[model samples]
Target: MDKQRENLTAADKKSEEIIEDKRAVQIADPSKNSVAGKDTELAASQVGYQDLFDNMPNGCVYYKVLLDEAEDPVDLVYIKVNSAYGRNIGRSLSELIGKRVTAVFQELTGEGFPCMETYLNVALLGEPVNFTQYFDQQDKWYSISAYSPQPGYVVEISEDITEQTKAEGERRERERQVALIERVASLGALAAGVAHEINQPLQALKIMADSMIYWYDKGKETSVEKVIESCRKISVQAGYITSIVEWMQDSVNKAWSDAPEEVDVKKMIQRVLILVQERLRAHGIQLRENSCDNSLMVWGDSRRLEEIVIIILVNAIDSFVCVDQGAREIRITTSCVEERAVIEISNNGPAIPDDIIGKIFEPFFSSSKSGTKLGMGLAIVKSVVNAHNGTIQVFSSNQQVTFRIEFPQYRQSV
Candidate 1:
């Protein structure tokens, strides 16, 4: 009798708990509530969500990811959005809440919205994604984070990054200005050296002309061979002057305008070699070429590409001057790696110490001679590479410093 009473007591308690659970479910269900109760609960839930949506500092949006027959997200319908979101997109909640994303912004589909595509993927796949978007139409930038709470819904948190982008652009412009100033300063320093270089050939020409005139005036039979040799000397010297002037002009003009096209990589390197060859020879530095392929090509501004090669070569040339008396040599090699064009320019000068190697590409960082302190060459090289969607790196070992640059391969259109 005592055991039966204990079992009965337990059964009664379990039944009462089940009844309480049902009542709780009923209270949560609006359909099970009285009309007034249903309205009150629904209003409370909406107020809670509204308070959360309005309190965020950044723009907040909830979208229903619309799907086609194939179950791919075809478009997005704005379900709920805060005031900040509406203000960001130049629309009000009343105007956008029921509208489709594609209907409002056609450019999104025409060009593409990689960021939005990722957001829809997150909603469909139940993952989270973060990306930056540049809206060309509104000239705004946004840092967005998106995640899905349900199968067909996405919540996006966005912050306007237009100011940040503007600041970055301003910084780049300032760097460009600094680079220009440094380039001008380098030209100023080289002016005397270049004049001296030109003077040597000029003096030689004067001597040759004087000798020819003197021989003719003395009634000496000037052989045709001698006259032809003097003429050839004059032509060579004149050609040298023309080449120097052309190189200088091209270097300056390329900085102002950059138009990209398919460029022959090997041919462009040879052009830079022509410009710097005399300087290298004057310094007793020997140049060795290896692994070069004539057919290698890249899509870029040829003149700008030449500038990149020139900067690296000139830097190597400068290093040779500062090194202790030894065999000065520069090795230029090129190869294709994973469909990317790779060029390695290495010099057996002094090794750049490990501590400063990383900073070599930083703006205004130079290890060059005193009074030539504008260290913007490598900085400019890096900027140009980044603009071209390429990469550059430096390595130093055993008194050898090398700069390795890689560029995307260009394929010709059929």
Candidate 2:
């Protein structure tokens, strides 16, 4: 209400100025009666235009859009807006009428109005705004529009956009929470499997390094082959631990990591499979592969990809371990399609329950009787897949369950 009162006061002052100017011109041109009449007509015309603007019901953001030399692009500054726009921004029309709309609303949007910026972007391209934005501070929303009234004049209208965005934010949060819960649960159930996975590689590395150390101490290490072999074993062991830690870490944060490096999919898969090979052998799960990328070069951190594959494999292995299932088997095959590299991990266990299939990636949502999992393995798998700009889908039938992942080829220069 205070803002509106200020606008009224300013409008009155402007009208008085127009009247005084007209009177001055009339007195000066009295010797030429026709010229004095023309001045009177012009003043009367401006009065109606100003009156219409002052009486409008809501906020108005009519602005003169400035364009570039090509006239196809709009500049983000120096645009003309109106009195109502000033009120919406808690400023006076007199101070805001000739300023750019972007400058005024930039602070209103929390992060600056992406919607308005987008609107202006389109408007500058000789298009118009037909959207609404909800302003939290003013407890209202706005419907906005823009047009090129003249060569550089962009007239805009903004009506109040509040209800819809709030609903959207609420909806997204609900989905995020649910997903986090299910994934954590899956991770919990797979705890035993993951431990065994890391331990196997460590065990091998320990054995190989120990043997190398014993030979060296006995002074029977006559050949350089012994030292080289021991160093190789220790290297392999450290490599395995590093890989697992990297993958798990990447899933939990959004930090900016360096660009994706070359991934030797075949060798890494074999090494990862080695980590879990004991579990696979114990469960009688068979493994097969065809590295069609020849290099199977994926465009992401190797360890991160390993985590994704490991999680899926662990979940499948867990499903079969349940007492209700009889035929236990999981197989992974790799392939390359155009710019994409794919890995398909399939298993034959009891068919997943219809009720639980879709919600599998949701956090704390578990079918594990072990009570260890909070159900996060598949959820992490999904996150890793998404981060890579890849896709993951599951298919199930009476006899088989298949999880397919497609990734952009690292060699393809994405």
Candidate 3:
């Protein structure tokens, strides 16, 4: 019921991908196909249309509406379904197509009743709904969406979000419980200095509050001045809380957000190097860029984008294996083509195996045999990049590995 829970409840959920699919649908009028040299007969064939919808890679559903005695939208019947939909829920089209909405969905929920209420509202209103709700009994994250194209029936689609959700949850939990503890311990080491600095502000606020209370108690018909002073004291306290929360949120989302923002492309490359300055110094890696042009601007979160560069560069530094390997160098270059910024970062390291390039983006995949390879760093980077509407590729040959990332400058975010 709190704000964050409410946010999760109202999130894009499974519909984010569904919405993207909707955008990809190029529905054309069957009537115009003949003149356009299109398959007019194929266009008019409802069976073919239904078959195509059913055969789609993703689960698809089509529901029919049936009204009640009161002329209100009351029932739902699945008029069409794809094989994926049936397989996901372990139900045949015949079993689900004619069932009442409440009857079929009522028992599948974890919280039982609350989820049912959410469904009923969507069914009655004839609107599409999306949320990251869980079916407690199923114990998995689902990107779920319910749509009612007509007055009385609802169509629903669900996608498993477990892997991505679990990764994010684990990352967040570690930051909250583990990383914060480390940060707090570090703060504790500076506790005396922090306390002494904080006490000054606390004392100032308290003195103002006390003076305001005295004035308000005295014979002032309307204590506007005192009220303002008290409000100012409250602001000071709220400021402290805001600072802590902002610091935490910046550390969290700046490093990783489900969605990435398009950045000024020319600036972002330089910015990435700035982020890895300490690492470059520590590893003795000489970094160079081919072009320092001012024209390109790519799309994506600079923070997460920079993380990818840092991870790859760190691996490049590690590839030296010995400090005596003459000079460790990483070269980065970028070009813009058809408004897409193509960034290439390459290192002169041992060649990556031909088989390994395909699996690098897979979660928990690593080339390193050491215990230190958590295996998810690159996976997170790829996920973050993908969510930004970009693509990443790797090419490896003798003594070199190249990561080529293409970022399109969306005039308006899609």
State which candidate has the highest lDDT: 1
lDDT, candidate 1, 1-414, per-residue tens? 999999999999999999998888877885766876878989999999789788777999889988899987888888988989888877878988988877766633365444667777888789898888888877889998899998899999999999999999999889778656655644543444455456656777899999988988999998899899999999998787778778777667765654578888888888878766667766788899986544789998786677778778877777776665359999999999988999999999888888889898888898755855567777878877876789999999977888999999888879
* Candidate 3 residue runs with Cα over 4 Å from true position: 1-249, 253-260, 292-294, 322-325, 412-414
lDDT of 3 at 110: 23
Ten-residue segment with the worst summed lDDT in candidate 1? 185-194
lDDT of 3 by residue, 1-414 (tens): 699887876676657867766555524444453455556655678678777877876567666655679776555556777887787666788877777545666645422333345555777776678888665655666787887666555676777787899999898887556434433332332233223334545566787777666766996454677577678777865565454345335545443333445577657667556444544655567788887464666655565565566566656666767544457778998787677777888987778887888888887787887765656656765765675678888888876788888877656646
- TM-score (all chains, Cα) for each model: 0.53, 0.51, 0.40
- RMSD, one per candidate, in order: 10.4, 14.7, 25.8
Whole-model lDDT, model 2: 0.69
TM-score of candidate 2 relative to the true fold: 0.51
- In angstroms, the error of model 1 at 177 is 7.7
Better of 1 and 3 by lDDT: 1
Pairs with backbone N, CA or C atoms under 3 Å apart (clashes), candidate 3:
14-143, 262-300, 265-297, 265-298
Across residues 299-377, which tens digit of lDDT does each residue of candidate 2 receive? 6766567767777877787777653433576778888788688888888877888887898877557787878666667
